[model samples]
Target: MNTTPASSPPAPVAALVQMTSGIDPDANLAAIDRAMGEAAAGGASMAFLPEMSLLLDRDRARSAPHIAREADSPWPAALQALAQKHGLWLHSGSIPLLADDGERRVNRSHVIAADGSIRARYDKIHMFDVTLPSGENWTESSAYAGGEALTVVETPLGKMGLSVCYDLRFPELYRAMVDRGATLIAIPAAFTVSTGEAHWHVLMRARAIETGCHIVAAAQSGTHADGRETYGHSVAVDPWGIVLADAGCGAAAGDGGYRLSFAPVASAAVDRARQAIPLARSRANRRITL
Candidate 1:
């Protein structure tokens, strides 16, 4: 009865759902609901949603079920329902999950099965604490607690790694993830228009090339009412760092991150026909310190 191989890889062809969110979680949920319906109707086998899929607020822990939305929160129920309804696996790239410490919140990413079961949870380890040149500043460490461990889950898509918006800036984190057997990565971000235009695609491509993994990055593009301008170039990159699909601004003004930021996690359907380029090979021009 045990005829299956222990090391068979998963299928390729992942779907990256990009969106634009605001302060209202309910409206955000409604948008994603409609988006998911459309994506499913379009024959997308899986979907990946971006960070703050349910809520984007300066207020602390408002999106967490226990904090603001509670059980009545539409995010969990809707995500579960959407997955079950479409018979697709969904990756909630990040959410305002209740933190281990009651005082703070966790920027957590959840992996949900088609049956509405939660397979894994990854709290963002690195926070986006930066003061941009344009006088815009974000202090994520103030209201949120950082995670200590990394998360990699086994799925129909193979080993799945978790990451959030600011995490994209840290390649060592991704390097660590890929070394731990992550063949596919999901990046859900609300990146600033400045950084997004300058480094977003380059960073995504670099991560994929270094890890030999396929990446599906869904971004928040456009200017938000919060006076924040986000870069909105959602991209899907292959293992060799080829950007296959780029959600460019058609007629949208400016490279704001709020053009659209809702996204989903699809199954890891990668073209493994390409050679397994391990990160070890990237140790190019290493000195013989031994």
Candidate 2:
């Protein structure tokens, strides 16, 4: 008698890079190049970068100067090459793309295939516009228009959802992605140090527990050229809400530069987590609309 064989489960290594990206795209690219190499060497099959990976200009007046179109941007081309060279899926957290008006830009995320092709592109749907208790204010809508679509992509790791930094605050978005079959979610962020200190870990773990999906979050830490400081604690969480790895900055590292961290991602973990909770399936029939 002949028996059917069980298919191999998906288990891919994911690397999340934490950075202190400044105004220079070239400098950022160089840092990214080294980090990617380090990640790949550590056996990572996929790598995630922080938001505004290409340029993090604090000066609102000069933000648009580094914005580039996907096709025309040297950053994209170089990133594609890096992905191809490492044979890894590269998730650029978010890049600044020039808008038609030429005055504002779009915060876009791209997933590059191991073959150097773009698998998916996601523009950030939610913009960060808030006034903090520290008297810090941000008006993201002034320079970057919000994206209207939710982006998900098929990859060797699993079905992945793409989201920028600010999008993490909205649990509805992650629920919607789970409805669309996302097993892992990418949250590339540059969260303010103040907010990050208060809520980063809790929020990250909350999303993982709520969605029953692995969370990959890369962040920018330290002060930028524009005088804004970001909280840097890049991390990966398992579907079971366990912290797989955390790239702690500041006192932990004692330096202000770039750091790369890795964690193992397995489809079986996702399966086990969902099987235990069964929340997604239970909510499948309930449609909640705004």
lDDT of each: 0.70, 0.87
Model 2 weakest lDDT span, ten residues long: 249-258
Residues 1-290, candidate 1: write the lDDT tens digits: 99977974434445666666667666666766666666666656567777776666664434344343224345676788878987777887677855654777788777888898888888888888999887778899987888888888877667878888888888889888877988888888888877777888899998888777777777665555445656767787777777778777421444222233222233332444134543365465567763
> Candidate 1 versus the native: TM-score?
0.81
Off by over 4 Å in 2: 1-10, 100-103, 251-256, 284-290
Q: Give me the runs in candidate 1 sitting further than 4 Å from their true place.
A: 1-12, 59-74, 250-290
RMSD versus native structure for model 2? 3.2
Best by TM-score: 2
Query: Model 2: per-residue lDDT, tens digit, 184-241?
Result: 9999999998899899999999999999999999998888877888998999999999
Q: Identify the leading candidate in terms of lDDT.
A: 2
- Worst 10-residue stretch by lDDT in candidate 1? 255-264
State, as a TM-score between 0 and 1, how close model 2 is to the true structure: 0.91
